[model samples]
Target: MNQLPFFITIPLPDWLTERLAVPMHLHDDEARMRFVIELSRENIVCGTGGPFAAAVFRAADGMLVAAGVNSVLRLENAVLHAEVMALMFAQARLGSHTLRTGGGIHELVTSCEPCAMCLGATLWSGVARLVCGATREDAERAGFDEGPVFAASYAYLEQRSIAVVRGVLRAEAAAVLDHYRESGGVAYNG
Candidate 1:
């Protein structure tokens, strides 16, 4: 007979926790994207996870709620993408299944455009805005399979009232992806 685990835990890397221990309150999109990009770069340097990172922030004051890096390799789980991890942690931190119920609006800042699964999670995450750094082409060029995300998919999110911003700090964000590829980082889904 096969055995199945009743529960699972996705542990955050020690470096990430230590970095986030200090409070942060970014004031603009560029700053937030830059912070998220740094997290992605550090994830690569720390060898804890994939070269991607995301954070959830309170839109009103730009206070970080939670941040997470891709832990697919670290946790040995395919669904542990950066965006998913961030959302899960943010929701857990807020003690709510959806971010909408919080007193303030929330936003998700990511170092790269979300893949198909992350996009779906973003929709259900109840964040008022989704800000992306690198483009899908950038990720694909870095040997990542970003799944079937179409322009219409973004339109769908907009239709549902989720503000979407893309290509923030493009060169900087894509450079991280390039660095990861040049360093021979594993493109797990490629």
Candidate 2:
């Protein structure tokens, strides 16, 4: 018989939680972009497998519900991508499996395009929108082995009523990945 891997909880430090906490609002694209960028930087500083970060925000008010950085090393869970971690944290805070709240959708913002696992999670995450700073090509260019994400995959998200916004702050997001490479960060594909 084959054995499957399981996940264990990885608690976030109090300092990190406090540092990432932000009020919910609307029309704060710049702030949200900066938040994700900082998350990526923090991830790199922590020496994670990938310098990526993600956040879940209230769509109506822009409240940051949860933020997470890549924790494959910290948690020893290869599947715990930043987007997944953020969603997990958000769900825990909301005490619900979904991020939707009273007809308002949640928004997911990530420093880079989500890999296959995270992308699939977005579909069932109850997030109405997704914002990405860097592209999969950009990550690949930086020597990161991103999952297979074809144009049709994005189209499918749109078909499922999820709004996809790419390149919200492309250059800035790409710079984070570049910094990771320059710092000799590992790009763990698995």
Candidate 3:
């Protein structure tokens, strides 16, 4: 028997790549919402990957630690969701595998509700909070195949002391998905 091996790579523009060098400070919830929406739009326009994107922030002051757009199609990796990418980048920037620090809380802000893999990543990311823009139904309505995420999934997060805020700037985020569908972007569900 033979075994096949695969690798993952995300090609980002110079500007996007430089985002890690500077600290992102989002003053309020509105700023964080705007950042996610813009990140989604940029992903679509720049042809990075999917229409979704995510950002990690310091829960204490809403300072953006890192941002990531989906790269599933670009990397040919099914688990490369926006939230996962953002968490990965955040960890890299902070030089820590976990986001939580001593007396400091981190937040995950995503353009849409997380699928199963991303949801699991969030739990393990060490972020103290999760804020989502669109819901699972919204993604399905846009023809993106999202993994099964039940209401209990959210309840479970809350049970674990992870604050969950859903449907932040939903229409704007959903509009990005609609645009992606209209633009005929590839919806690769692996």
Q: Of the candidates shown, which would achieve the greatest lDDT relative to the real structure?
A: 1
Rank by TM-score (best first): 1, 3, 2
Worst 10 residues of 3 by lDDT: 7-16
lDDT of each residue in 1-190, candidate 2, tens digit only: 7587585568764556778665545357667878888878876775654678888888777878888888887777788888998999998888888877534678999999998889999988988899999999889988878778899999999998899999888899999899888877777775
Of the pair 1 and 3, which is ahead by TM-score?
Answer: 1
> What's the C-alpha lDDT at position 57 in model 1?
95
Q: Model 3: runs farther than 4 Å from truth?
A: 1-11, 19-21
Q: What is the TM-score of each candidate against the true structure?
A: 0.97, 0.89, 0.90
Q: Distance (Å) between predicted and true CA of 101, model 2?
A: 3.8
Model 2 TM-score, all chains together: 0.89
lDDT of candidate model 1 versus the reference:
0.94
TM-score preference between candidates 2 and 3, better one:
3
Model 1: lDDT of residue 132: 98
Q: Write the per-residue lDDT of candidate 3 for residues 85-125, one digit (tens) a residue.
A: 89998888788888886347899999999988899999998
> Across residues 1-190, which tens digit of lDDT does each residue of candidate 1 receive?
7699999978899999998899999989999999999999999999998889999999989999999999999898999999999999999998999999766899999999999999999999999899999999999999999999999999999998999999999999999999999999999993
